[model samples]
Target: MTSSPTRQRGSKELWLDAAYEMLVSDGIDAVKVMALAKKLNQSRTGFYWFFADLNALHIAMIQRWENQNTQNLVDRCKADATNICTGLFNLMDCWLDPSLFDARLDLAIRNWARVDADLEARLSAADRVRIEAVAGMFRHHGFCDEQAQVRGLTVIYTQIGYISMQVAETRQDRLARVPHYVELFSGINPSPHEVARFLARHV
Candidate 1:
């Protein structure tokens, strides 16, 4: 009979995936090395092979957020010349999607940063990157630089408000109203065809 893989054989990717799973499901407090090891059916030594400590894993999670989520949105907007508004709308959609948004993990990081100045600074830098990228996309879509900055701020604030309201309302209720808010902010009603054509150039 073939032998099953052992904990000692676990790879770095395996550990990272396990960490992410725990983060999404249970929050930062549950991201202990022992908890991860138990989740993965591995030993503490297995975790040590990939991360020096729980803090290292937390840092990796933050870095992954920056690369996978943040960079992807920024790049998507940067790539398309016509779909700036569509892309921004799509971003808000994705952010509110329960399958996509890890509320527990996000809250944990934000709360942790309250006690760590360095982490607060790092997170602030990350927020600036997202803000600037959104502003650039607005400018590309025909708004002047100053106008784009204001629009971008509007988009960001609207998204923040949506997230805050989500706690008190159902996701379906919030999503149903997104278009109205979007229309009020964007002003021009570009057809879906225009957005598709715009996005096609980047693809």
Candidate 2:
């Protein structure tokens, strides 16, 4: 909706997206209602129409992150579980796609969790759900439970670490190493088709 005074009606996403942008670019502390109102060029009254308070907006933001990052990641991985290579490729897509994944937001929430026990527990639960989903994908490919767990953790933790570290690498540079990384993570060299498919997305 337009932010003009004529009609201040706006969708929940409009407010949430503004808040998310602030969270990612300026950290969670900057996601206040006043900042959001200013960012959207709308009056503070519009915010109350959508969210009860700053805490409500924060809860909505966290829920959005959980749905998009954790639940959706698991579902995508499971969708391609018939082929482990494809499944791995799908899982890696979360790392490669900005529209699908927001590393900045991920890291920001993790940092937020460090001091908030409830948020920490939420993140911990999301981690477990993600790990199990990836591990199930591996198990579907015939890996034993223990091996699947290890490989699952390897893939999940590796991506988290890559994101958490804020690694600096050009798109082409990372794409160049995709094949080798896939093989190392899955212990099976990706087929020419798989490699091409992956590079096609990232590059």
Candidate 3:
């Protein structure tokens, strides 16, 4: 998202985008004022206008990751769904769509958190909040407390594992199995109608 050749006035967001790209593409160490400015084709001083220091920029990136990756899943769980299958499918949308949930950024954060105790703490808290939200979805659909909790853990961990493993699979294959996955995770087989609608969205 960074522009070329010159500084764009009011490029705070451009700097953020450049930093985010660097963090995921390289690592946290790559997110320097000089590096970001070079990425944005702006002077190094431009970064200071938007952030006090690299720490401030780091905080901004973490907040974006939390808001986009964690909050989106929670909101999806709370979205309107006519049945358990449909509800679970709503959460699954994140796995299929990068914009809905950024797997790269999530993995990048997990890697970053390993070395940073404070960030690791935040990451842990975010995981709990996410699990609780998914559990709440099951509860809303009449699952027993234990069932809701276990299923929520299963659902969340399954995704985490997939991202961690960096498992490679084609979109077509994943789409074909969506219904089965929904049934397995939701404990309720989705109707053809529901499956078709969900598939239409991804396709």
Best by lDDT: 3
lDDT tens string, model 3, 1-203?
86653445347788888888998888887778887777666776778878888899989999999999999999999999988999988998999988889999999999999889999999999999999999999999999999999999998898899989988999999889888988998868799999999999997
TM-score of 2: 0.92
User: Regarding lDDT, does 1 or 2 come out ahead?
Assistant: 2
lDDT of 2 by residue, 20-57 (tens): 98888878878888888888878898899899999999
- Error (Å) of candidate 3 at residue 130 is 0.9
Error of 3 at 179 (Å): 1.3
For model 3, the local distance difference test gives 0.89
In order, candidate lDDTs are 0.66, 0.84, 0.89
lDDT of 1: 0.66
TM-scores, each model vs. reference: 0.76, 0.92, 0.94
- Judging by TM-score, tell me the better candidate of 2 and 3: 3
